[model samples]
Target: MASTTPTQIDQAPPVTSSGRSTGRAGDKIFAGLSKGSGILLLVIMASIAGFLTYRASIALSKNEGNFLTTFDWNASANPPVFGIAVLLFGTVVSSIIAMAIAVPIAVGIALFISHYAPRKLAAPIAYVVDLLAAVPSIIYGIWGALFLVPQLNGLNLWLDEYLGWTYVFDKTQVGVARSLFTVGILLAIMILPIVTSVSREVFLQVPRMNEEAALALGATRWEVIRMSVLPFGRSGVISASMLGLGRALGETMAVATVLSPSFLINGHILDPGGGTFAQNIAAKFDEANEFGRDALIASGLVLFLLTLLVNGAARLIIARRKDFSGANA
Candidate 1:
């Protein structure tokens, strides 16, 4: 038997100009498409920001109230007084409350689905969670307004009675619990499914070998999860929580339906009135004139900036942890 020479073994296959040109053309087309898409996204974002800033400047110039500190929103007045203090307070407070409630519950549910649940039960539960994520926000709003508000009255009373010393829970006046706290609860329920789904997916991706090693070292199921799963999924959970936070921040209908709009800043979240940015816009848009619309756009710009800041912070945290995780691995 004759052995092949080195040159013969290392010989390159013949290439046709037609095939090479076709491949080059395909590559150029794909590269152009991707570049164009990214440019288009940047352009769209810039356009939105520029338009909002221009309108906001016009409205601010005509304003009779401090934009940052004033509580009233009377844009239709001759001097057109308006400010975002109340809206900012409500938006941030409600979002914080929602995050505090939602994140832990979501993590627990994700853990249960990923590790604790019976194999037979996990699939169905996960399916239900996915279904819940797809349910319309308007449905949540309607349910929150008609059913949740009434149902929460007892709990609200109980909290005010027991936890009123906290001041945040204190309800001085007699009224329904159509407040920021209620809105927070509603937002928690609305965001729960998405967070759980994302966290579960992350947990499920944990390497089985890592868990098995922990088990072999006499670690219990919870111990294995703590040592292996949680660390691997920390970034994912953070991302999921941020997604839920964004949803809570921008939610309109549910907040509008559940919250009795007020332009005042109240520390008591169980009381009957507080307002969020999206809720404020939705509630006042139809009655607003051109200047009023500009003011709303300005508020929207604030919301947009807030979301960007949150996402940027989360990315920074993830980047910092990436090196630590890589080193440990």
Candidate 2:
């Protein structure tokens, strides 16, 4: 037999001249579509931000008053003057109240569903939560207007009679349900399902190994959750809060239905105080003049800024936690 040469052993498979690696045609198409879709989405977001900013600057340039500090939102005529202070305050206050009411209850319900409820019960409960999310904002607004408003008169009466010493409860009972407290309650109800669903999913994702280890070490169920589940899902909880807050801040119809429109800056939740940006825009945009439209756009710019600030703060908190954990590791 002829001896095999080293050259023959060293020989490699032939390659096509094209630099592309071999892959299925379908896979290549899918990859291209995915990348193109991402680029398209990014471009769309950037364009929207740019357009809003440009319009807002034009509006601000035409106004004579300080846009940040003024309490009123009258934007009717030429050289129109309006500010976002009252609107901004209302938006922030209502959202804060919503979160305060929603977060704890959401977490508790999520925890119960994931850890305590039977499998059959859990599925139905989760379905109910998702259904709540699917309910239209307009429906919520209508319900708030018709049902919630009527119910709140009794609440208002109770607060006025029992808690009258407090400034928040000191407002005269107008027999109308339109108040900041009512809006806050409605917002809380709307946002609760979102936070609950997120918290449930996150809690369910906890590692069984970590939980088991905690259990094996003579830890109670509550202790195991405290040691392993809550800490592991802290970031998820924060993300859920931010998501719920986004909804609360931007919700127009529901708030418009529940809150009595006002231009004054007041310190009490029970008082008819001020309107949010979404409510203000929705209530008056059609009636607004050219400069009024521009002013509304400027107010939108303030809301855009607020969203950016909130997201930035959340990121900072997440980043600092990551750094601290890395250092400890």
Model 2 agreement with the true structure over 1-329: per-residue lDDT tens digits: 24667567568555554656656677989999999999999999798789888888888887777898987676775557788988998999889889999999899989889988999999999899888898888889889888988888888888888888887677664548677778888899999999999889979978788789789999998999898889877887887888889889989999887788898777667776578989998888899877788789888878887887777776776665564333233
Cα-based lDDT for every prediction: 0.89, 0.83
- Runs in model 1 with CA error above 4 Å? 1-21, 327-329
For model 1, residues 1-329, the per-residue Cα lDDT tens digits are: 24667667568655545355677788999999999999999999999889988988888888899999999999988888899999999999999999999999999999999999999999999898888888898899999999999999999999999999999999987888799999999999888998999899988978787778889999998999999999888888998888888888999998999899989999998988889999999999999999899888888889988988887877776676566455335
Clashing pairs in 2: none
Backbone clashes in each candidate structure, one number apiece? 0, 0
Candidate 2: which stretches are off by over 4 Å? 1-28, 315-329
